[model samples]
Target: MSPSAIPPDDILLQVTPALPLPEVWDAIVRPEQLTRWLAPRVRLELREGGPFELFWDPEDPSQNSTQGCTLLRFRDQDEIAFTWKGPPAFDALMNRGTRLTEVQIRVAPCPEGIDVTLEH
Candidate 1:
């Protein structure tokens, strides 16, 4: 099945990280590998509807973590999308609010290495 459609947003970033497409894909899918670069604490289940939690604070789980979000789309080696919650500082405004944002990461092989497009 095709990956879920990510609604258009003004926030967009495109980068060509110096890593092979497969490696880049692994970096996003493998929590163990992602912890080395992405976030200090990573808990991600790489399947459609799987849970994903990324903690930035090593000292506190409730401080800066995406605690109860789940994957909306999971296309192996191609793309992924998950619900997103803001940090604790925005707890009252964003986290406690009715709607939650979504983050999508798309990857492809490129001359430089892996071409990445992240939409939030």
Candidate 2:
């Protein structure tokens, strides 16, 4: 589907990882490691209706975080979904604070590889 076709309520980002489900999930979900690749610092409670925040700088520590976040769904190393309600950054300039409401991530284990789908 095209970017325009995705509802304003949902956005999807998919990635294929060469590692096992647990390994991939751990690396992606780990706050410290996630900052290195995805953002700067990630703080997640990994629970239903918990707060999930991502900071732009780890060293500064006073930066604004992506707030109003919550884990809506989770299935161990299989699937996860959360609410992403913070202001958008440079990449998502048009969507800033627009309630791109739900971010859904799915982990599919197949014979050849594992498909990681992230929806924001």
Candidate 3:
């Protein structure tokens, strides 16, 4: 299904972080911040069409990672879009790179602080 066709509540995550928009963007793009919240090993190129790989297993990258996937969109302090696949446990479906899903993250200013919306 297309992105627009997906329902707002389906696999959608929203959070109002205390940090500013820039800091929230850092949590989405920075290596150190990524490791703290996301996978242990991450390789993000920070540009459209660049790599946005995340390795859940520290020793073996191929075992569970978004290997060979690329960023669909990248905007500083605004948004990021990247292709993603499941972990090793779902090898049958996840290994099919062409059938992978897209993960999008949008960071915007809000009344309290920064509002981050993630859709997958």
Candidate 4:
């Protein structure tokens, strides 16, 4: 079956961090900084219209993190939704498409810290 056969759903990941909302956002979402903890390297054009790219391994930037890895949406110091593409078997079972089927991340403070949640 092709990835287009599956239905699309909004993936949400939330986590609570000790730091403030803006601080947490800077630490986790900022492209260059995110690599230190999250991925190896992230090039994010944070805007309503921008390209978001993440390279899991500095050695190889062409391959997606998995299969459907892409950035869908991002809210400053609040939320980030991205396509999760990895593990062929798992990707077929969960993520199989030009678009991402799963998002792995943290959400902090509806108004203010970090609330982290993962959705697929």
Candidate 5:
């Protein structure tokens, strides 16, 4: 389905990090950096429309990780938008079908450091 077709009940998360924009960008895009905090394992291609997968519990045989996610858009250190499909329970809660939800991360320079906004 087209990205615009995603439902309206999206989850949003934001934070301000005491770091520069470039650093914040790396923490979001780089697989090595992302696994440190985001997920247990992240496989991503840093390009528009690239495929990505994040495994939160790789060792758990019964858990369904965030599979078939895709990178919808990427703009240097400014913004990154992707698709996210959580486990079955999440799908039930969100009343989602086969279509995946959208997650967007925006980075901007601030007086103190950098402001990061995550919309899912």
Candidate 6:
């Protein structure tokens, strides 16, 4: 099916980390930080429409270990949105093929620290 014809089904994630916005933004964009916390390996280009890929199992060295994704939007220390094409299991759960899904992350200052909201 064409991308435009795919129905939308998004997953949202939210968290309030006891850290500043800049730190949170760095953790999201920096490859080193992402490898430490999010994925086994991550490659990101800090620009709109840039190519991005995430390796969940770097040791596997196979297509199944990688997630072919992309960066769609970026706002310094505020928000970043990306396209996530995870494993086939995820696509099966979403009832779609290999169509990319949107994952948007927004950061805002809160009384405690920074509020990070991730919507996919």
Using TM-score as the measure, the top candidate is 3
For model 6, residues 1-117, the per-residue Cα lDDT tens digits are 233443465455678999978788899899999898888888789898786778887776344434557788998988888886656555665425656667788899999898888
Candidate lDDT (C-alpha), each: 0.81, 0.69, 0.83, 0.59, 0.80, 0.76
Off by over 4 Å in 6: 1-9, 61-66
TM-scores of the candidates in the order shown: 0.82, 0.71, 0.84, 0.62, 0.84, 0.80
Predicted candidate 3: what Cα RMSD to the true structure?
Answer: 3.1
Report the candidate with higher TM-score, 4 versus 5.
Answer: 5
The CA lDDT at 48 in model 4 is 39
- lDDT of the structure predicted as candidate 1: 0.81
Root-mean-square deviation of Cα positions for candidate 5 versus the true structure, in angstroms: 4.5
Clashes of 6: 1
Worst 10 residues of 6 by lDDT: 1-10
| lDDT string, candidate 2, 21-99, tens digits | 8888877567877776877768788889886777765565443556556778877888777766543344364335544
Ranking by TM-score: 3, 5, 1, 6, 2, 4
lDDT of 4 by residue, 21-63 (tens): 6776687678767877877767677653355566676575544
Candidate 1, residues 53-88, lDDT tens digits: the string is 888886887878888888999888888999989787
Question: Candidate 6, residue 33: CA error in Å?
Answer: 0.5
Q: Candidate 4 — which residues are off by over 4 angstroms?
A: 1-14, 62-69, 87-90, 104-106, 110-113
In the range 65-88, model 5's lDDT, one tens digit per residue, is 667778999989998998877677
Clashing pairs in 6: 11-120
Which structure is stronger by TM-score: 2 or 4? 2
Candidate 3 local lDDT, 41-112, one digit each (tens)? 889898888998998887988878888778999888888999888777886855574677788988889899
lDDT (C-alpha) at residue 30 in model 1: 93
Q: Model 3: clashing residue pairs?
A: none
